[model samples]
Target: MKSLTSLQHLSDQAILSILEQADGTEFPDFANRMAANVFLEPSTRTRCSFEMAEMNLGMRSLSIDEAGSSLQKGETLYDTVKTLEAIGVSAVIIRSKEKAFYNELQDVHIPIINAGDGSGDHPTQSLLDLLTIKQEFGSFRSLQIVISGDIRHSRIASANASVLKRLGAEVWFSGPQEWMPDGITPISADEGCRQADVWMSLRTQLERHDAMEPVFPNYLEQFGLTPERAERFKPHTILMHPGPVNRGVELHTSLVEAPFSRIFKQMANGVKVRQAVLAEVLKTKEEKRYEKAV
Candidate 1:
């Protein structure tokens, strides 16, 4: 595939390939190819992981600042990508507040990896999350995973649910009623915690709701991961978040350092997963080029 805008773009085989490569111990080189990251939105994990992935692959990199880029001077998305391509970048990683922002670059020639797009999808995050889970369970078949918190505005949840379910995992949602997605069976946070092999909490996107007032007055008591709730988690249950976590909102501060918390593991796995993606996409492109030349 030329670009990965959503988990739907990945087949089961492709997903397995990325997970397998991420599990490897050896680092691969990509000669001296170049890639650019254009993040029009604020980020910490996604941006840094992609940069680290390129560096690990022996590629030169460029990180575009929203304020300094030509976008500040009225450059369109297409123009920005074309400029990167003109400068010899064969791949571009982009994150934007606009949903499916990469859709506008269909004819841009260069490979576009969607770091994030509004509340759309974060495919790389999903892949690394899968890697983290697979490392824990050694398989996805029938594993119970409960994603709790602001599901209504979560791109991670959207990408993960699709990919995890596709891989034979049983995915469920738990959060504020208003924040739950349609069609998914919603369970109480406490019940979800009890049954889940993987309990993934999400930050409440207070910025997305009109009633920016906390979802509930004592949200910690009602929904957040309190000490009592933490103790109730299944013996081997894993906890996670796609962070910038609100300490006392979706999860308790202590759980951040809990033994079962795989938050940092997920971050570390992100680099490996992204490396796999960059290698696969760029390698495929180069092979096609060689075939045409012959």
Candidate 2:
């Protein structure tokens, strides 16, 4: 309770505890009582991940969107954050299109779990991803993870790369010149996959709307991931995506469902990582409560 901040130095044991919780096996409280967001950005995997996190831990869940909740009246982001905190949201899981979504939170001090902040960072996403990585290799060192495609517009690439690098993997990237992350090695698509222990395909987000470039398909043919391309990698290399994949665009759908795919496992780990985050935040609050009374 003396601390109110989330730490990047989260312990391995604590991380393990959450993973265990996700099994719905046995835990002290299930404290199963938490509040979080849904459908703000038309999500499937993230939306469900937070919801399942709540159910598995014993938290009643709620959904919010333009049509779902009343924020349609030009309410600002800070107001939204403050209101949620005021109503005792112990932890918040957000997914916003704006890259700086949590930047101007005029002191809305709840534990802001970044489900995503556009192409900026998705901290929880990073956590689950690393969890998946750890689950696959039983450790973080020396795993060659390739993050491919949509470099500029995909949060997963940045988050996954950050986490992978943090945990000691040699992470490489491959995508269009425009989408690449700054200050990282960019390998040719084939070479990247060839050397990787995990291949993560990020969806090309351009064609979602009507106004887009004509060179998209050409780009896909060159950069998109396919089974043949994926086969160039180590046979045990895992495949991943943050979903809403473009079938045959950034990646070939069949390859994504290949035997080595860990996309579903990564998605499933989101619930566990969130439960861990929520547990730490709420436990901090409870500790503070007792300290204040004393």
Candidate 3:
């Protein structure tokens, strides 16, 4: 078993195992968690998911914000991390716009759970995505998922690509050249959708500041998944998004509330997935101690 430096820490078999273990516990006693919340970027879903996961595990937590920390006094990120670790932090659930923080963090004794990092990878999103897929399709094999919009700046897309591919599924990239990843394909947007077993639409994150002239007008005309296309793949496909959704932009508002949509359920899985991750980490730590005693 590998330590969870990234989402790839848990294999497909491990992921299912963790989920199974989590199922044996009730909602409020999922994994017996206790940790420090260290968020650099603002988040609602990641924050609440992690907190709820901790609560479900019957653990206490501390939430740190820039305004209350010496980080505002110009403390280096390394210093901040060291301070958190020194205070006996069991783990740090971090959200940063810089990837360097995540890379440097992998060497630490304390576990680091990335909420989001420099638009690179969001593993938890990948986990919930898998949970959603399993819940709806009842399996992961041979699923054709279309990833549309902001591919160049979408960490969720990258994580999804890796996790889905590892689980024996196909993924297509769709978006304009400016917003899309360079030299990668399923290049055509319309075609990607037409053949998709599932369509996952993403918001164009202007915060990445990766693209210019942010024109998002008439989004439904080109990028948004509509009622018509929904019916086209209705027999075989599903739609998913990670949002603060742009109502008429990347997806129709109605689709967000549709029976097939896993938006809310995904958020709920955030807690369970995280709870399972913490449990696994704790179990590993305990076994090491037992080995030393024996």
- Which model scores highest in TM-score? 1
lDDT of 3 by residue, 1-294 (tens): 324545676768887776566545544343444588878888898888889888767777889877788889999767787888787666777888887466765557666777788788887777777887887877778988889888888889888888888888988888766776667754565677678887888887888854445676776877667776676665657778877677887878888988777788778877878887776676676677689899
Off by over 4 Å in 3: 1-3, 22-33, 186-189, 210-214
Q: Evaluate all candidate structures by whole-model CA lDDT and list the values in order.
A: 0.87, 0.69, 0.75
Q: Provide TM-scores for the models.
A: 0.96, 0.85, 0.90
| Range of the 10 consecutive residues with the lowest summed lDDT in candidate 2 | 1-10
lDDT of 3: 0.75
Per-residue lDDT, model 1, residue 265, is 97
**Residue 209, candidate 1: how far off, in angstroms?**
2.3
Q: Provide C-alpha RMSD values for all models, in order.
A: 1.5, 3.4, 2.5
Clashing pairs in 2: 1-287, 1-288, 32-57, 32-58, 32-59, 33-58, 151-179, 152-179
Which ranges in model 2 have alpha carbons more than 4 Å from their true place? 1-26, 30-34, 182-185, 207-214
Candidate 2: Cα lDDT at 99: 75
